[model samples]
Target chain A: MKPKSFAYVRPDSVEEAVDLLAQHGEDARIIAGGQSLMAMLNLRLVEPSILVDISQLKELSEIGVRDGAVEVGASVTQARLLAWPELKARAPFIALALPWVGHFQTRNRGTVCGSIAHADPSSELPLSLRLLGGEVVLRSKKGSRKVKAEAFQQGLLTTARRPDELITAVRFPVGVGAEGAGFREVARRHGDFAIVAVGAVKVAGSIRVAVGGVADRPGLLELPAGGSEAERRQAIEDFAWELGGYDDIHASARYRRDLVRRLAPIIISEAA
Target chain B: MRRIERDEIVSVSFELNGKRAAGTAQPRTLLSDFLRQTLGATGTHVGCEHGVCGCCTVMIDGVACRSCLTLAVQVEGRRVETVESLAGDEDRLNALQRAFNKHHALQCGFCTPGILMSFTDYLGRNPKPSEDEVREVLGGHICRCTGYAGLVAAVLDAAREMRGETEPEGEPHAA
Candidate 1:
């Protein structure tokens, strides 16, 4: 399948990019790496009249610590982030999961912020951001606003970002003292989308388990750290039931729930 | 922000296989089609335009990426290396290609170009990759024939040859 022909523009600055967005509104789409957006376009799933390319914006390519988190800009590709020397110290879970985002080929061209912008329910970046308490920085001609990952991701393939907004960056908070995080997923193949993915982070005697690929959106559940093995298993099982997995071609509702029940504890225990 | 109209044809210029190349394309033309249809470099095959099949893989600025997922204009002024770049000195097969021939890595030869391009990039960065690491990278491609056993052997063999190590006993020399 070929994409429907569309106008293309490469803006030199973030302001110009947002200006283009405000000018075109719903008719224009912002493209960073064009890894996911181009695939959607090739499938003809999206037919915007124009595409604003922002991969060349130098202002949006920073990967430095800001406030208390590592702010990844829109132009920071997945391969770039993984190559950052401080990635393991700043965000170990992301480092562990980045290799699973795609193959070496796609990761070279896929941006970390682009994945958050896409907000796929089964994607590793979204689930990791949600569990680690991150924020998405959105900009437009009007102004800028920061939305937490929980509120930013509305539902399946939907986000709180407006048509005129450009996701300039996403902030993943730096790991605090002695905080341990772990991520695991079961997919049909290593590089394929996960059938069920689980992530866990332990801090100050509490553990948070996040589940993806089994719900309309990635979701998180919290439980105390010192519970008995059986108690922890029961709590995870109840949380799995609450998620209410549905049948799909890849996995059944019951099977997804079972994976959650099985995977949550292992991840939590590993994090602990 | 100057926009190219949907129907406007623009000259997309890039360095292909160590030479300057230029082609005209619409804004939506994929790099794979631009290379094949416009530049006549058909070694880069397109199996699935959506980036899953990994058949359209090529190198941009020394990194492997799916040309089908990249627009022709996006690679403007960039250096692109397709399967055509692998051969050397009167079109002799490269070390990886020789290993693949020794190991019988391909039965249909459709996915070989992408796989060879990937290995070229991979071996440059990691000259001593383990078998599992080779398989991990090879997993990105989907090959129906040869069952991947030969592919794994070829990659490991190629890695040894690139590392300048002597061949083991009774191992056939990769031409």
Candidate 2:
């Protein structure tokens, strides 16, 4: 289906794009890769008056190491991020969940920040980022601020981002100590959005489990390191209660809650 | 809503088949529709408009993208090559296309173009992808027919043919 008519602006610089977005305010949308926004537009979910095309903004489509952390530009495509050697070594959880993203063709145009901004509860990237304690860098004409992934996503398809702001980059802390990561999700079909997805990271002798698709937003649980099996089981059960799963066409709320109770311990055990 | 006037359609210029081309497109027009309906390049098909099905896949600046999910105007000044441009004007099928035919990889041929474009781009990057890598890359596509065994074999066969390990035989000519 065709999308509603809108004005298009291809901004060559990030500053120009930011200015355009600020001018358009809520009526404007920044499109990078256009993988998600295009689908939404065609579905008429978002009918913005102006589409600020930031694909040409070279400054926003980069991946590099800075201060011992892998900093990925917001426009960095999922395909490129998976192929990035640094992400594999520095942020292994991101690497593991990259393949589960929508098939190869979609990943070619889907951006890392775009996924986070879209804030799909079932999306692997956002849950992985949250588990890794990633921070999103938001910029606007006024100033720039950083928000942790945990606090960034407020609800399903919701974020802390303002209408005029743009997500410039996402930063992942490097260095590993007792840190292992595992990602598991169940979907009706390969490449389909997950019915339930879990990402776990063992760091600093503690295990962090983030559950997606089963809640309004990704739910995270932090367990004390070197815990007994009984303690781990209790933690998993408690985490399930905290998750408060919701029912959808993919799975029932009860089913999701049960899966979390079952999957969290498994992921945590593997990561531990 | 107000009617969209003709002047509202913007002229988007891009490189198609290595030649510069321009077209008037509305903001809502998808690249796949623009190619097939507007430019008469039927090689790119629309399977799932949501980008799940790769049937509308095309090489945009060497990366496989679902054209049905890409806005035509967004690709201005970029390079786009559909199946029509995979082979040169000489009418010779590309090695991947030939391998697909040689291995009988397609049954209904509905998802062939998208698969071909995706695998072509995959092999371009990793010329000798292992069976597991082939599965990993091809997992992005969904083909109900052929059970995907022949598709995987076709990709492997194409890799071998590209490396001069095998000769093309009884290749299915594009219909």
Candidate 3:
């Protein structure tokens, strides 16, 4: 099937893109790698009147470590990040999760910001971001604002981003004074969306966890510091309850909950 | 960095199989359609019409990507290698194509072009891949026929040939 005919534009700068988005609103769709949006467009699931191509925006192509955080420009593809020594050193979770995002080819064209913006409950990037306490930088014609990854992801395929805002970049706080970190996921196929994805970062005294694909949004949990094995077991069980999993074609709600119950310890143990 | 107004004609020019090809497409025109309709490069087959099936896979600037998931306009200045890029002359078959024929890696031949384009990129990067790694890459592709036993052999054989190694005498079976 062909996508409905629409206009396409590549803005000279982030501001110009924001103005176009602001002017067009719902009729406009921001396109980066086109890995996700193109699927929707080809299926006619989303038929925007305009597609703003940000892939060529040089301003949004930088990946750097600054002020204790790793900043990835909106146009930076996942494959590029996977090869970046700085990102792997500063934010180890990204390195661990990227290969699981999609196949090698999709990663070549899929942007990190696009993944975060897609906000799929099954997306590995956002699950990792939420666990690491990242921030999304959104710009509008008026100005820019930073929203925590937690607050930005609203629900399934939904985010808090306003219609007029364009995601310019994302900031992930690099784990410091950390003991270890690990990421794991189970998909029917190697590159398919996960049945459940877990990312864990163990710091000086405690374990932090984030889970995706079991609910409308990824769930974050901080287990109590330094507890007995039983206490930790109970803590994980209690945390699992908060996920609000629902039945879907992939797996039942109980199965997803069971995955969290089982995988939580293995990944936490790996990170530890 | 550039601005295009609504419903405006966007001329896209890119290297298609080592030759310059240019076309005008609506923003919605997919690269798969561009190759078939504009350049008459029908060798790159389209299936599933989405990213799930690797039937529309092509080399975009040397990376394997789904042509169905890419707009024709997006190939503006990139190099796209379709299945047509494989063989040099009408009489000669490329090493990969020959290996596929020898190993019986394809049936119905619908999935061959996309698989070839994909491996053209994959085998270049991983000239030596373990069976698991080959299987891992194959996970992205769907093949109802040949069961991939033959495809893996084809890739391994092609890799050896690409490395300038001569095929050992007699019907060679993948070890």
What is the docking quality class of candidate 3? Answer: medium
Task: Please list the residue runs of candidate 3 whose C-alpha ends up more than 4 Å from where it truly belongs after superposition.
Answer: A176-178, B1-10, B165-175
True contacts kept of 1: 0.86
Model 2 chain A worst lDDT window (10 residues): A172-181
Error of 2 at A116 (Å): 0.8
DockQ of each: 0.80, 0.43, 0.67
Per-residue lDDT tens digits for candidate 3, residues B1-175, read: 5555656777889999888999887788899999998878899888888788788899998999889989888889889998888877654567888899888999988888888988888888888777877777777788889899999998888888888787644443442
Pairs of colliding residues, candidate 3: none
Selected candidate, larger TM-score, 1 vs 3: 1
The candidate 1 chain B region of ten consecutive residues with least summed lDDT is B166-175
The CAPRI quality class of candidate 2 comes to acceptable
Q: Compute the DockQ of candidate 3.
A: 0.67
- List CA RMSD, all candidates: 1.8, 2.9, 2.6
lDDT of each: 0.89, 0.83, 0.86
Enumerate the chain B TM-scores of all models.
0.93, 0.89, 0.90
Write candidate 2's Cα lDDT for B152-171 as tens digits: 99999999989888667754
Positional deviation of residue A153's Cα in model 1 after best superposition, in angstroms: 0.3
